[model samples]
Target: MKQDIHAIEVHNLTVSYDGKPVLWDIDFNLDSGQIIGIIGPNGSGKTTSLKAIMGLLKPASGFVKIFGKSLDEVRDRVAYVPQRESVDWDFPASVLDVVLMGRSKSQNLFRRANKTDIGIALQSIEKVGLTEFKNRQISQLSGGQQQRVFIARALAQQADLYLMDEPFVGVDAATESAILELLREMKSNGKTVLIIHHDLQTVSDYFDYLVLLNTRLIAKGTPPEVLTRENLSNAYGGQLTLLSKIVDLIRQNEFPVREKGFDL
Candidate 1:
């Protein structure tokens, strides 16, 4: 069969920082309309891979193609939500002001946001359940509300492929649920989403596909296959040996932590 043209394809991607290698020769293809999660221990190049894909960092030796086109050629078709902590929360901007930044690339530098842009931004904010808080300063909202604003920004971009970096890190349960629901809706609408996530326990529940990384691609498949004990060991290392064992047991029994009374 012919390869799918509408896929995110990374080929021989190697990235380094100050002569020190971070990501090494990674390759994978992800098609549209699936919620894919990238998981690994800290310093496993999860964020690095995302930065490279988003063109925030230059790869030493590789390329990423979205919808079978170079990033520059399809820049507008891609939306990225960087790590929440990466920005200054104190910036003086309202929630809607921040979300409208998503449309910046489409407008000339001197052009002001048009009515259409504002309309789209409002719609995105509503989608994330933040319509009432759109006029509020971003820093005034709770951590989860801030995260939702970022998600709304990405939605406003209206991209075909969404790349997020650890979106669930500091958010509350309600915000996490809201984000996941929006992601599922995006997938149902035929948009592909790749999230950099750290939680191993919730991996199986949140993603339809998985990418396990450790300075290199470890495994990419359905959660059942990629979250295996051996794969977790390879990705997270022997330090998580006991944790991996517990996860494996949980997988085998298909029981929730409360059901098993195991402290996670």
Candidate 2:
């Protein structure tokens, strides 16, 4: 893809279920080589927007472009990691087996994985710190391990852009930190990762760009620009207790603050 092209361009996107809108006329553009987060309260359509971008769900209106082209035009350059809970753990696949699936798109459907493919899969597993578990059944792995397996699968794809939904939802702190480190490494290598995330306290620390949504586009910018009192209230309906915590974080110098010419 061209360096000047945005990683993703979502224009006037809307999605609905049973005629009730889940996402309403949302719009945003993400630059390449950064970690971006989509954050919102429960039932706020965070995952819905992600699915729309990935073409997993049909939008009621509007469109999405990946790297200055339609999703079908650049699908090979994108990788998607769905929520762990949405997957079937008992599918009887080993870690290596699942990771190799990432390479399937590049090979003949009826062909078996070649030595090169296996090598790539093993390298991806090692990157996730799961080399020993490569042969273990996914169903036997812990929640964190299972999550890592999916990440390894995405890594094996070697895509330029990664779209993940709630990757940190059920993992331990160590796993979360490891995943963050890996994501940072990917960013340094010029990969753009857009994640659907919760955990407001870590939003500023985890992502370079932030998209705050609630059935519509609330805010989209750097963490300091989006996590302000007014934007949070607009997206989250002024939940005082949550807002107070964010305020306290700012006062304590925990959350990010704009350097100049802007106020929270």
TM-scores for all predictions = 0.88, 0.88
Question: Runs in model 1 with CA error above 4 Å?
Answer: 1-3, 239-264
Provide the overall lDDT of each model, using Cα atoms, as 2-decimal numbers: 0.85, 0.89
Model 1: which residue pairs collide?
none
For residues 147-200, write the lDDT of model 1, one tens digit per residue: 889999999999988999989978988888888988998888888899999888
Colliding residue pairs in candidate 2: none
Residues 1-264 of candidate 2: C-alpha lDDT, one tens digit per residue = 366889999998867666566776788999999999999989889999999999999986789999999998888899999999998999999999999998877437788989998999999999999999899999999999999999999999999999999999899999999999999999999999999999999999999999998776889999999999999988887544554454455546543333333321
Q: What is the C-alpha RMSD of each candidate to the true structure, in Å?
A: 11.0, 9.8
Worst 10 residues of 1 by lDDT: 255-264
Best by lDDT: 2
